[model samples]
Target chain A: MMKSWDPRIEEMPKEDLQRMQYRLLKSLVYRLYSFSPFYHDRMREQNVHPDDIRELTDVKKLPFMFKRDLRDNYPDKIFTSTKDELVRYHVSSGTTGKPTVVGYTQNDLNTWTTSLARALTSVGLGRGDVIQVSYGYGLFTGGLGMHYGAERIGATVLPTSVGNTERQIELMQDLGATAIACTPSYLLHIGEVAEKMGVDIKKDTELRTGILGAEPWTDRMRTRIEDWLGIKAYDIYGTSELSGPMFTECVEQKGFHVWSDIALVEIIDPKTGESLESGQKGELTITILQKEALPMIRYRIGDITTMDDEVCACGRTHPRIQRIQGRVDDMLIIRGINVFPSQIEYALMAIPEVGQHFQIVVERKGALDDMLVRVELTKESFSDKINDIIQVRQKVEHRLRNSLNVNVTVELVEPGSLPRFEGKSKRVVDKRSL
Target chain B: MDTQKFVIRQISIFSENRPGRLAAIAHALGEENINILAFSIAEANGFGVVRALVDYPEKAHDKLFSLGYNVAFTDVIAVRMKDQPGGLYEVAKVLGDAGVNIEYSYAYSGKEGAVLILRVDQVDEAIKKIKNSGATLLERSVFH
Candidate 1:
C-alpha cells in the first residue's frame, strides 16, 4: 500500500489532500470571480459556482488555463492583485513567443521564497552556507530566485548574476562559496575556466553543493557536473511561471519533491483533457494554492512529466515527480514524426566528437518535412575525420530513428561555426521559410 | 550558363566536438605547402565543408586523406577581386543574373586581393565571366 514516492503525500490520505485542496480551492474559486476578469467571466460562462462542488471530485468543474492564455493576457492583464501590492516580477522565456510576465506581492514573495527554502532544504543548504547564484539577474527567475531562498535559509548570498567567467571563479574561490545555483551548462563552463586558471575545481575549497536548473539536464550531465566540481549536484525544477524553485531533489537524490504547500500538482492527458492516474506522463497543471498578487487555477504548464503519491527514499513526506523530459513546445514533427530535441541533444552529447553547439534545421521538401542536425566540433584547431564524421552522423541518425523514431539528416560542422547563447539557447530552426 | 570551369577541390572532413580539429587540418595544409587563401565552412546539422583556395588543392586533398581523415574533393571556383565591400555583392548579383543559385559560400581576403569561394547556381558561365574579368581562378595549392 506504500510506494516509494507516495509516503510523503500519501500518508496524508485522500481526505487530507481534499481538505487542504478544497479549502484553498474554495478561496481560489472565490478570488477567480472576485479579482481575475478572465476567471470571473469564465466561471460565469461555465455557470459553475464555488458551492456547486461538493467535494474535490468536482475539481474538474474548474476551467483550465493554458500557456497561450497567459501569453494573450500577458502582464497587467491576468493580475488578480492590484498594482499597489505587486512587489516582485518573474518572466517566462519567450522560447515559444514573447515571454509572459508574472508579478507577486510582498506576501507572495515571502510564500515563494519559503517554498524555495523548502526546496533548498531538500538538499541540505541552510544558514551560514555561502551560496553563489550564477543564474542571470534579470526578469529571469534563476538569479533573484535562489537568492530569496538562500536568504530565507539565512545563508550568505552571493548574487553573482551569470557569467563574467574570471570574476565568477575569483569570487567563487575568494568567497569560499559553499553552494552555487546556475544552469548546468554555465557550471560546466565555470569549471572549465577554473581548470585553465590552474585551480583544480575538484581540489578547490569549500564548494560542497550545487543547485542546478533553468535547463533540463540528464543524469549523465549530473554526474558530469558533480565529478568535475567534486560536489553533490541537486536538481532544482522551477520556472518564473511557478514562483521559482518549487521542486528540488533531496540529498537522498530520489527525485524532486512537489513543494505542495504552495502549489497543487496534477498530471493530465494533453489531448484527452482528463487527469491521468499516477505514474503516467502528461501535461503538468497546477493551482496556485497560496498567492496574493497572481493566483492561477489549473494553470496548464507546457512542461511534460509524470507524478506519483509513492513515498520517496528521502525522508520527506511529500510526493516526488520525475525530472521533466522537456517542454511540449520543444517538440518537433519532421515528416509527421514526433521528435524531442532533447533526444538529439542526448544522442549527440553521448558522442565524444559532437560538441554542445548543435542546430536543427527543418525545411519542407515537396510534401515531406526534412530535419537536419548540425553538430560542431568542440573547438577550433580541431579537424574532423571524414570517416568519423560520416560514422558519427550515421550513429546519430540511427539513434534518432531508434529513440524518437524520426528520420533526420545529421551534419558534422567545424568548431565555432554554430551560433552560441549567453542565456537559454535556441535548439530548433523551422526553416520552412513560411 | 556554360561558364569557365575552375576546380576548387572541396574536402569533406569529419571531426568530433572537441578542441583541435582546425589545428589538425592546418598542420596537414602546412606539411603539404597547400596555401589556403580563401576558405569558408558552411555549418549546420553538425557537419560542415572546409572549402579552401590553395596553390595545389589536388595535392592538399591527397595529404588530408593520407592523414587518416575521410576527405572528399569537389570542384569549386575561387573568384579574385579588388578588396572592397560591394565586390561580394557584385559577384552575387552577377551570379544571380546568370541564374546561379548559391548552394554555399565563404570568403577570405588580404591586402593584395580578395577571393570568394562560391558554389554557384550556374558554375560554368559564372566562371567564364569571372575569368574574363581577369579574376585568377587559383588552383588548389600545395603552397596553401
Candidate 2:
C-alpha cells in the first residue's frame, strides 16, 4: 500500500494550500520585519510592508535574498531568534567563499526532524526497517537530518556515517539493514568496494531501498545502482537553509513532492528574475514558511528545475519538482553554446564503456573556448591496444557532441587515474580567464 | 615454441610527451642502479609510451610505480639479426610471409648481432616463424 507521513498535509486541495501559503507568508513577513534587522531594512528599502502581501503573488514585491546576503550578514544578522533561543546550528562548506550559517530554535528543530521523518516514511521506510545513514555526520546536515527522521519513525538507526566501506558492508549484511540513505555516488562507490571484497550486495545484504541525494545523479545511474545493489532508489531534495532532505520521491519515483505547509516554491527566469510558467525549466526560489530562527523571503536556491502540479500516483497533493538539472552556477558557456555538467554526466553515464569518474575542463583557446572531457574507462574495458582505446575515445566524443551540440575533446584516461571524492564530486574545472 | 626459450619482459611506462619526462624517469631508474639496456619511446598524440628492456625488470617496475608513473609489462620476442643492411628486411619478410603481423618493432646493434624486438599479434606463432627462418632467439638472461 502507498503510505504518506501526513495525509492531510500531503493531500490538501490546491486552493487550500495556496490560501495557507498566503496566510503564512503574511505572518512570516511581519515576523521578519519585527525581529530581523536585515529583513526590516530590505523590506523598507523596497517599500513593501506586511500589509502589502495580502495575496501570495505579492511575495515578488518583497526583495529577493541572494546567497550573498548570508555572506554579508555573517554570523547572527539573519537570525530572527537570539542565541539563547537557538537549539542547534549548521554551516555549509563555504567552498566558494564564506560559509552560510543556519540556526534552529527548539521548535525549528522539531519541524526539521518531523519533516525528514515524513520524507523517510513516504519512501516506505518505517518501524520494522533498520535505516543506515551513510551521509557524513557532524556539521553536515545530511547525516543527522536523516538520522533524526529514521528515529522518529521508530526504526533502528545505524549511525555508520561515511567511509569504511568494508565495515559498512559488514554492518549492512550482519545487521540486516533494510534501508540506506546516502548520495547515489557514494552508494555506487560502496557497491564497487563490495565487489572487490567478493561480497555480492544484491545477494548478501538485506538492503531493499536507498534514499539518494546531496549530489545530482541521472536516471541511468539510478538504473545501474538498482541493478547492482538490488534496491529501489528514491531521490530526496533539500538545501541547508530550508532544512536538509525535506522533499522526497514516493514509491512512484515520478518526482519529489514538496510539503506546501512548510515552504513556498517559485520558478523564474534566472537572467530576468521574472516568474516562469509551470513545466518551464527555470531557477527555483523558495521561502521557509515554518522556519523560526532565520526566515528568508524569496531565497534563491540556484537549483534549476520545473514544477508539476498534477496529482501523483501516490495521491499526494503537494506539487512535485522535476529532478534538478543543474545549479545555475554550474552552467558552462562554450563557443556560444550553453552546457550543464549534469547533462554531460547524463551523456557519459549513458555510454557503458565510460566509468563514473569524469571531469569537464573549459579552456580559452586563442579567441574561442574549448571544452575537454576527461573520462576513465572501466577496468574490464581498459585496453592496451592504442587503436581500440582511440576508437572508444572518439565514440565518447561523438556521443557528447550529439547531446551537447558542441565539439568536445574526450580524453580516455586509465582506470582509477582520475580523482574521486567522498562527498559532492567536483566534475568541472573552468580555466578560462573570461 | 621452445619451452627452454625465456620471454623478455618489456616495461612500458605511460607518460605525457613533454621535455625532461623521459630523463626524470631514466634518472629514477639509474638512481636505483638498474641498467636500461634497450629503450624506445612511441609517441601518439600528446602522450608517449616508453618501453625499456632493463637488467632487472621487476626492480625497475617497482621503482617506476613507486615514482607514480603508469607502468606495465608487455612480452615481446627478441631475435638476433645481422648488424648490416637487409637485417630488418629479412625479419620483416619472414614474419609477413608467415601471416604474422608485427604491431611494432625496435632494434639495437650489439657485439653479437643486431637485437630486433618485435611485438606481434601472435607471440608463439612469431617465435616459430623467426626460429624457422634461422634467426637466433635471445633469452631473457641476454639482457640481464
Candidate 3:
C-alpha cells in the first residue's frame, strides 16, 4: 500500500516544484543578503546582489557556503535571527577547533518537525507504532530530531536514547515496540548483545522497522541488520546545520526522498562546483527554503551521491538521492586509486569471520603508498591453529583486493583489540604525511 | 598424581616491544607481592611475550591482567639439571630424540642447581623422556 504524510507537496507537479523553489530561492537570497552580514559580504565579494536573482537559474549567482565559512563565523555571526527570535539551537562539537552553531525559531522548529514527520511517514511509520529513539540526545541533533518527529506522527515514542543494550532489548520486548531509530552501527550492536543474552529479536520481539542514519552505511549492512533484527531498515540522511534527519528512504528502499518544499537539494561536481545532471554522482549541496532563524543558501554538504528526479513507485514526486556514497573528506586516494572506508567496511562486514571492529592505516613506504586494513576476527573464528588463522587472514586480504581493486595488506588481530566508538566511528589513520 | 600440582604454570604476558614495558610488568607484579621466580622475554616483529614463573601463577595472572596487561598461563615442565656446561644440551638432546618439538625453553639457576623450563609440542612425551633419562623434573611443590 502507498501512503504520504503531505500529499499536496509530495505529489506536486514538476513545474510547480520548480516554481515553488524559484519563489523561495529569490526571497531567501534577498533576505539573507539584507539580514546576515556573512552572506552579504560573501555575495558582495562574488559581485552578486539581491536584484541579480530573478529566476531559478540566477541562484548560481549567489555565493556558496562551506564548513570553513561556518567555522570562520562561529557562534552567532551566521545567524539571521537575533537572540530574542531563536527558541532553541544546536551546536556541533567541532572536534578540531571552533564549533558550528545553528539556531531555530518557533516556526523553523515547526518546519523541522513536519519535515521529519513527513520523512518518517514515507517509510511506513505512523500512529500505533511504538518507536524507540536510540540516537544520542543533547547537542547532537539526531536524538531529539527523531524524537519530536515520531511524536508528531502520533506514534508512541520511547526516548530510550543510546547504550544499555541489554535493558534496551528488555524494554522493546516488554513494551512491544514496533520501530527503532538509531545509527545502523548501534542497532547492529544491540542485536549482538541480544544474541549474547539468548534473545532472538527476529523471532522474540516486535521490532519491525528501523530508521538508521547519521553515519554512512552500506546496503550489505542494512541487509545484515534486517536479517538480525527482522526489521525493514531504511536510510535517513541529514546534517546538524540544515536540521537533523530530514530525508528518508521510502518503502521501496531505493533512495532517500529530499523534502524539496522545505529544503532545496543539488548535486555538484566537488572540484568544479558545477551542478551535475540527474543520475550523475557528485557532492550534495543543500539550501534551506523556509528556514528563518538560520537560512542556508547553496550550502555544500560534503556528501557524494546522485539525485533521481523520476517519480517513485510509492507516488512521491520529491527527488530522491541514490544512497550516500561517502563524504568528500572521507575519500582516500592512494596511487591514483580512489577508495572509501565505507567500501572497505562493506567488504569486511560481508565476511563472516571478520568483525565490525576494523581500522585502515595508510602509511607511506619509500615512494609508494601502503594501506593496511587491521580487522579483528570474531571470537568464534579465532582459532589456535596457525594454518587456519593464516587462511582466514588470506581470505580477507583476497576479498579486499578483489573488491577495492587495490592491493591492501590485511592484518587479523584478536577480538576486542580494535577501538570501538559510541558515535560516528573513526576508521582511518593516515600517516603518509603527504 | 594431580597434574595441577606437578605441572608448573608459566605466566606469559603479551607486551609491545618497547622500553619500560617489562619494567611496568615487574612493578605491577611486585606491588602485589608476587615474586617472579624465573622469567624469559621472547620478542618477534614489534611485540614481545614475557613468560615468567611466579610463586602463585593464578595470583600473578590476575594481577597482571587487572593492571591492563594481556597475560595467559601455559603448563611448562621445569627439569632440574646439573649447573655445568652441556647441561642444557643433555636435556635438549633427549627431547629432540624423543621427537618432541621444543617451541621455547628458558633456564634459571638456584641453590638446587640449574632448572630448564621447556614449552614443547608434546608435554607428556617430553616428561616421559626426562623420566627415562633420570633427569630430575622439578614439580610445582619445589618452587614453594
Q: Which candidate is the best by lDDT?
A: 2
What lDDT does model 2 reach? 0.82
Report the candidate with higher TM-score, 1 versus 2.
2
Error of 3 at A143 (Å): 0.6
For residues A1-434, what per-residue lDDT tens digits would candidate 2 score against the true structure? 23877788888888999999999988999988887888999999999888899898888888898877886778768788889999898876332324568898988878888888778888888888999999878767888899988899888999999879899999999999999998776787788888889999899989999998876767887898898799999998887778667878888898898888888889999999998888999999998899998887889988899999788888888888989887777756564334667677778778888787788888866434679998876535444456655677789999888777668998765456678888777788988652
Interface RMSD of each: 7.7, 3.5, 5.0
Order the candidates by TM-score, highest first.
3, 2, 1
Model 2 C-alpha lDDT per residue in residues B16-135, reported as the tens digit of each score: 557888898999999999998898988766556788899999999898877666678888889888888898889899999999998888889888878998778888888887888888
What's the lDDT for all of these models?
0.70, 0.82, 0.81
Off by over 4 Å in 2: A331-427, A430-434, B1-144
Ranking by DockQ: 1, 2, 3
Give the TM-score of each candidate: 0.59, 0.61, 0.63
Candidate 3 deviant stretches above 4 angstroms = A331-434, B1-144
Worst 10 residues of 2 chain B by lDDT: B1-10
lDDT of 2 at B50: 84
If you assessed candidate 2 against the hidden native complex, which CAPRI class would it receive?
incorrect
Better of 1 and 2 by lDDT: 2
Q: After best superposition, candidate 2 residue B55: deviation in angstroms?
A: 34
The residue pairs in collision within model 3 are none
- Give the alpha carbon lDDT tens digit for every residue of A1-434 in model 3: 22788899998987899899999988888888887888888999999998988888777777788866776778878788889999998876332324578889998889989998888898888889999999878877888888999999899999998878899999999999999998776787788788889999999999999998776668987887788678999998887788767888999999998877888888899999898888999999988999987788899978889999999888888899978886777766554234667778777778998787789998766434689998766645643234455677789999888767567888765456679989888889988652
